[model samples]
Target: MEKTLVLIKPDAFEAHHVGDIIKMYEGIGLRIAAMKLLQMDERLASIHYAEHIGRPYYEPLVSFMTSGPIVAMVLMGEDAIHRVRELHGKTNPAEAADGTIRKLYATDGRKNAVHASDSPESANREIHIFFNETEIYD
Candidate 1:
């Protein structure tokens, strides 16, 4: 099975949508291989969003992410990365397709309800950012 990282962001958690979000993934056949509730720090945010470091949205992104607790999870299934991204929908709620997670819960581009790694390489990198090897269950 392929493994990918998914983050149910602070907005979703604060709004008490964790169960609903997890249900969405479960309903689609993905298994939760690892999970945690974490309060991110600036250093970790910078590491995770390193590619966006110099961009205009970087600082605010970090600030918002660190503003509250988030749920980090590893989802495993065939084509896990693509499946989760499909469920997550667009980065902007306004453009996300109907019935998608972001379309249903997000308020703006940055406040989009979920995050998923875009590729196998990124998934591996992102998963490690939030979890150690022993934390994952196959």
Candidate 2:
């Protein structure tokens, strides 16, 4: 089985939609191996989004992420990385499919309601960033 990192962003938490979001993932047969609610720190957010460091939205992205508590989780399943991203839909809600999580809950690109690691390497890296090995129990 593959593993992926999933983040239910602050907006979801603030809006009280965490249960509904988690239910959507569970409905897809994704197993939650580890999870937590955390208020992201600037340093951690910077490291997590290192590739976007030079992008114009980098600063704002980081600030937005740290603005409230977020739900971080590690999901395990077959083709988990790609599967979770598909479940989240496109980065921009306006372009996401009608049935996608973002399309249903997100208001825009910058305030997209969720994040999923794009690859196995990124999944592993992001999983470690938020969870210890033991935390991801079978």
Winner by lDDT: 1
- Candidate 2 ranges beyond 4 A from true positions: none
Per-residue CA lDDT of model 2 for 1-138, tens digit only, reads: 998999999888888889999999999999999999999999999889999998999999998999999999999988888888898999899999988899988988978899998888888899999999989976
- Quick one: how many clashes does candidate 1 have? 0
Which pairs of residues clash in candidate 1, taking residues 3 or more apart in a chain or in different chains?
none
TM-score per model over all chains? 0.98, 0.97
lDDT by residue for model 1 over 16-74, one digit each (tens)? 99999999999999999999999999999999999999999899999999989999999
Model 2, poorest ten-residue lDDT window? Answer: 78-87
For candidate 2, the C-alpha RMSD (Å) to the true structure equals 0.8
